[model samples]
Target: TGDLLPPLVHLGAAAPSGLVRIPNSNPGTPETLLATSFNMHQVTRHKLTLAGASFRVATTPLLTCDDVDFHPTDILVDADGSLLVLDTGGWYKLCCPTSHLWKPDILGGIYRISRKGAPLIEDPRGQELAWRHVPVEELLRRLADPRPAVRHRAADQLVSQSQRTEEWLDDNFATRPPAVRLQLVWILTRVGSDNAVTCLRSLLEDDEPEIVTAALKGLSLLRDRGCLEAARKLLQHPDGAVRRNAAELCGRTADRSAIPDLLAALTRTSDRWEQHALTYALIEIADVSALKQNLTHQSASVRASVAWALQSVAPDQLQAETVLPWLTSETPLLQQTAQLLTAQRQDWETPLADWLQRQLAGGGSVSSSLLAVVQHFGQSEHVQRVVLAAAASDTLAASARAALIRGLGKSGRHPIPQDLTDTVVSLLETSHPELLQALLDWLRASERSAAFNRRIWPKLLAIAQDDHYSATIRLQALALGGEERPVLPKPLFEFVLEHLDAEQSVPEQLAAVAALREGTVSPLQRR
Candidate 1:
């Protein structure tokens, strides 16, 4: 192994060790051998004789690593007589420094070596085939070649020789194998000429559903608005796959004119996947009114899909009259779906707030759904109601409280009322990490007046210096204090500096540094 040891020991040595004979059927050719040379980064080929083996330093290496750290390990001669050289690569120096143990680089790959004119006995599925000089007719025949490489190359070249090949493809369209015809349709799309669109349109009427689907895909790829009429016709096709592909293509076309056809298709199929495909197409076309019509669908699943589709397009179109009825549905899925849709719509604020007020007044426990409604669309008035619910309901779930806190934070888009601030500040005494984090987030997001900052700064300063609370909560408190200018008092400034100088975890030190920087205090100035 140490036969070719380099003089500098620390840099490592080339350990050329394992050897294997290459099996050859030709008696006339000299016997060949392969071996690994680690540090030199080459698979050293040799000539084998009955007496001994001699190294053959050919102009081209059997395999070589361009990168300096590659370590060649072993060699295998496949049945096809191709050499498969395994590279261990650099592991210890690059990855596992402490262990100093040899391990192969996870990213390393095998190197294949074969002599000129060597017949590859393995499956020729992806093997490269020459196609340049082959006649257009000959290339068409190669489309049926078992190897994908041959088929793909032939299709590419045939499309490049466009005029004659297109005519031949059109003439032989009915007589050719379905697979070959499909490949032709794909080729035409790549050609993307006006004639290709005509060819794809014709294939849309083919008897084979698979061929029609492929043709639809090709037409969609062309993305020509002219193809929209043909795609719209397939929406009525008996085959679900064809209709699905056609609907998807119409969406990709993004023609508002396809809205009526997409809506008509939605009424025909109860198939969830098909309905989903149609709903998405309608959404892409931005037909808000048509989508709102489907909100009244008899099937809850369909209504849910329509609701989800509406979530993206027209949240304003989501009426409380339509969605409130869904919340009362027997199905949980529908109820949850309605809640999500309501949460995303800003216009639902007044109605949803009224519903929550009624629910709380009736002595109902706060639900996450109510909180979601407020979180997304809550006003300052809605924020006060949520704070009252949180205070009154001692039995409130942690998740519900968290949701309420998030809603309160989101409501800070408007000026926070003094009552809301006092309510939030009193919760800090609970020292609950989630609530504290939520309060910090709310303070950061809120537009605090100078007076509000002056009032909150001392309370936040106590949280920042306290060791009883988690580093995360304390860091958040520090971050909240940093948001307003001139809020960091002189005492808090020295406390932050001391914390930065103290031996602390990476996160704690980072928090202290950030707080100091945001307060316009530089650590370098102290030096």
Candidate 2:
């Protein structure tokens, strides 16, 4: 029964039996192969050979059984010719670990061998084909045979051929049907020779989409310098698929000059697939200038892609500020683009603040996206300046105040500047109590002098006394002062002390007390 030891060979499922057959009969032994489950996990099985027939021993010296890179395609023969081991490439080939493996243009290859002196026939069910010793050249000749069987065998054999067959491929390209031509393109790419490069380049002007697709696939596989150049030029090809493929190829090339072509492709195309592919390619290049330039593209889709692309290119350059005003643009697409740009490059905060000021004057509402962008610029002096400016505005000013307070609190740079304190104090006097609390958090976060907080403390306390003070603001004010309400100017401090004793809800009274206490504790003291 052909050295039968194990009754079944597991394909997808687990092999439970620990015994297998070994070919080649060794002297004094029946010559059986043993398959032992390596661990209880049942995922890996170890193979052992029988020599004199007492027990099994691993034949490989100085290495653990696990050191081997086992695959189903590999066949191991024992020294005594007693064992024939088979590891099919099916698992490895299907899972495709080597698919992305880095191999030089020429050294890597996969081949099929047929020992029957004829090519291996495909399994009728269309699952897989394997055999012993069939040369790829023999298969190529059969591709032109009059018989359909001869052609199918030849076509299938090309699947495992090395990428070095580009010259042979070019010579044969004209005779093959469009379908086989496409297959040849794929085969030639794996060959990765200069001839393959030329073939793909020639296909750039092809009228058929399949031909162009094959060429693109070949170029992508070759990925040589010439391929990169050809792909860059293809960005402007009359066909959309060519243009789209060119963008995709550029992403793989990672060449900087490809950036301009990718950007052009992004702007010139309106089809969503082309736009999406081009956007990703541009982002992969990490080209900041290209992103900024497209911020003004005529298509809203292109404009949106510009925003997505900016995240890939860090806005480290000085010119990023030039695009800051787009953050306040009425067009949502441009506004989204500007927001992402500002978030990455804090250096743009200065110009972004300026833009917001202009927008406020133009009667624009502080959109959430703009607020998010400003907050991401982080709590720097520039950000603080904008926050304070926003706090000082009358309409749509609450959003700005909220952004400033958040920036100051989370910015790791607690204690806003004394100048900021001066602005906050002035705004509190005329603004709603809600606005005052927002300013107070920023004031407390800033490590300003006692003198700075002291100067503003009186004004904040007086706001606490106004019966109109909401419970939330009243509590914030009390926290600022505490039990030992310090004496201050009669108008502000006296107002606070009276309010602290006023009959109110506990939360409101506490707020007044807190504000009184905060007045004494300088930002530095609180820290």
Candidate 3:
């Protein structure tokens, strides 16, 4: 519940999942210039990104830059849990100082930050070990050293002897703890050799989901067909993450072999996003045979997933027989899934048109899924009547009305029908930002539509000039009005001119510049 502090200057590489030493470089005395704030003091508190999470460290400076000449360049964590900071910034010149005071001194110092009573480190660098001629086994043991510097250096040495490393891993990988094994897994995957793949395959059933998922991720890189059995078994894993990683691996491998477990998992899995991952695996396999055959499977969930898969990856091959059951099924989720499929294929026009008519006649409510698909059906007399009626309804929800407007614009089916012109232009009368944005987006796409006639210009100009609205709304209005670079009448010219001085947002200024790019003033006004 405190103010968000600005970032520390010149932060170093991320540490191994804890607070590590780092520097605040170019500590030019506190000042602001050109909107850049240089507020480095001999003081600080900050958050750092470590392993994809932000951690706020002690809200006070651990060690202040007591001397202006001391700017730390790097920080290292010793095995004893002390931080060794390298202050090499003393020798370099940091320009752009607002104070006009600068110092250039060739002086540097190494400073250590440590707890008052922490134990002393033993073999911090394994100095007593045989580094000049260390054995591979010794290096492997050091991979789990309490010090990151020690572990990484040992890993580098071990990996250099690839032949012996792989042989040792084959016999001894399981003896290590999860943390050490995780490191080994990443190193093995990076090598990705024949023996490495063979070793990784055995860990598919590791007690740790992380270990199994990491193994699958590594195996997936090679699209190794040998792991299909492992992948198939893991598809039914209880952990959603493991299941997802396994599903991705299965998809990448694409074995012609059937994965009935994949369909079974789809029936049982409750997470919608995870179901999508499983369904994606089916799509990648694109087993035209399995997808079509499974449409008759007794499990409603499997049938829904199968029908959706065929429609997604093999739409033309998706027979009406395959999708019809779910489209007309009493199960609401299944029917909605099928209805969504209609938005994808032009051949499914009848279902879409009939649904639009129902939305108009059945009252104004639209299901979230159904609303997403309706805009794709806006063309021809069958669509225009219902879509226009929805757009013209002041009582209909704003989101539904906005969607209908989007549909009409996408029809790209030209020549605004004279009868529907009023309803189409009527879209501009609403002040709701979503509806206005949808209309402008349509206008941007259909620049030559007769709907953008003399009547549309004034409303477009007013929306662009209004400051009471948000920047996004104003930006869209400017986009439609600016698209043609029209020689605007004087009042219309002033309308677009007012936006030129929008100092804060670069986008608003750019919009104004784009509107004025090539056009010139008319002679009638020039006189």
Candidate 4:
């Protein structure tokens, strides 16, 4: 009853419609929907790179609303994979007032499409079986059912019996297939009882590494101190997956004793996946005193990792003097991470501009991230010089040049220096779109001066007069030329006013409107 609005004369949907193509009157309104499905992945394999994801691709779609105005508000999948579609794009005016001027509410359809040759599935909601009173053995067998709804129902009932769950695990867990065994560990982990924890501890000795890794993952979430020793032992497991899971478990438990093993693992593997887990564990534990003691390690990579972990633990203790060795190093990760760490100190902003200038003067290799640091935080006379130097260079990359100019535009803390006016004017010949846009943004941000009128005005007038440039750029040029000047250039106002006709494109006309709003007009010059 709350959805009401006065009648809209320009309703985009046509009446007498089951489904019709919606008109463009209300364009670009996004639709939101609800969906029903569970994670369909089996627990048997550990190689699925996207952990805890439930997405699957089917070779053929169950139904498609192609060539129709079809937007469904909700979708449901039945036990046999049949799809129920609720299409409401036709007559349901989402929030339009419940008006009597015209009725369009009775217009959507509910559709169901089923697989042709598949066997029928009985709905569990029918409750033919007394689920709680069902025999324990039958419930265990149903855990292997093909339908997710059935398997979930069985687990929901079996989770209530801790003694029975433990007894079944001691007697029959090994003989079941790996998939079923993994499922038992998952179900017990949900109970959060003594028997559940004990059952998980027993499986840590299982012969299969994947089974052991799965147990480690569950225990990590439980975060029991009793399993800390058990998790610590797998830190050097021959399998990388086991090591990763073990590192994560130690991190979650916050065991101070596991720091040594975590460090050893970090220095041993060059694999980024292993490095990520080990680094995450160290940061989670956050023992800065211990992390600092490892700085003397012989491997530069290990030292760099420790330095990063240390700074992350205590951001205030960072000294750029100690870190410059890494910021200037050949190792890409160390240099990039060091840039992020130094950028935290806003007092160091001018120093960043100095560093860039020194690099430029020496003709040394400049990392892209270091350049970004200078551009993002730097706002000084040195920054103006850096932008001017980068702009005129033919050897510098286009993106690097653009970043410097953008930094100048973003410098609100410090005044835009007048020294850059000539360099900004010389950019008139830049053919790169990104550099040209950055220059325009800088011009718009800078405070106008006498130098702006004498140097920048001429180039802007040329751009406005030359037809080679797009109309949008030309109109922008015309607007920028007279924006701060008390009197609009006679030639500039005359040319634009003459072309304000139906023959110009809509964008040109709109840009002309913005220019007219900024510039002054003389009563004597009106024609």
Give the TM-scores of the predictions, in the order they appear. 0.49, 0.50, 0.51, 0.61
Clashes of 1: 0
Please say which candidate is ahead in TM-score: 2 or 3. 3
- Candidate achieving the largest TM-score: 4
Candidate 2 wrongly placed segments (more than 4 Å) = 1-133, 137-186, 198-217, 221-244, 250-264, 268-321, 357-378, 389-415, 440-460, 480-527
Quote model 1's TM-score: 0.49
Q: What lDDT does the true structure give each of the candidates?
A: 0.66, 0.55, 0.63, 0.63
Candidate 3 local Cα displacement, residue 335, angstroms? 5.3
Model 2, residue 118: what's the lDDT?
45
Cα RMSD to the true fold for all candidates: 16.2, 17.3, 12.2, 11.7
- Each candidate's clash count: 0, 45, 0, 2
lDDT of 4 at 229: 84
lDDT of candidate 1 at residue 376, scale 0 to 100:
50
List runs of model 1 lying over 4 Å from the truth.
Answer: 1-107, 111-133, 224-230, 236-241, 255-257, 264-276, 292-328, 331-333, 342-351, 362-384, 390-527
lDDT of 4 by residue, 1-527 (tens): 00122221221332312211111111112212223111110001111122211111212223344423444545565555565666554455444332223335545566776667978777633256567667777877877766666776778777876556665655646676665666777787887677777778877877766677778888988997788888888887777777888888888888889988888877777656566677778778888888777766766656666766776677555455666545666677667656666655565556666666666564434466555555554555666777678666865677767766777777654555677677777886677767776776676676666556566777776777777777777777766764554456677676566557778888778778767776556786554
lDDT at 419, model 4: 72
| Candidate 2 residue lDDT tens string, 262-291 | 766666665655676777777777767767
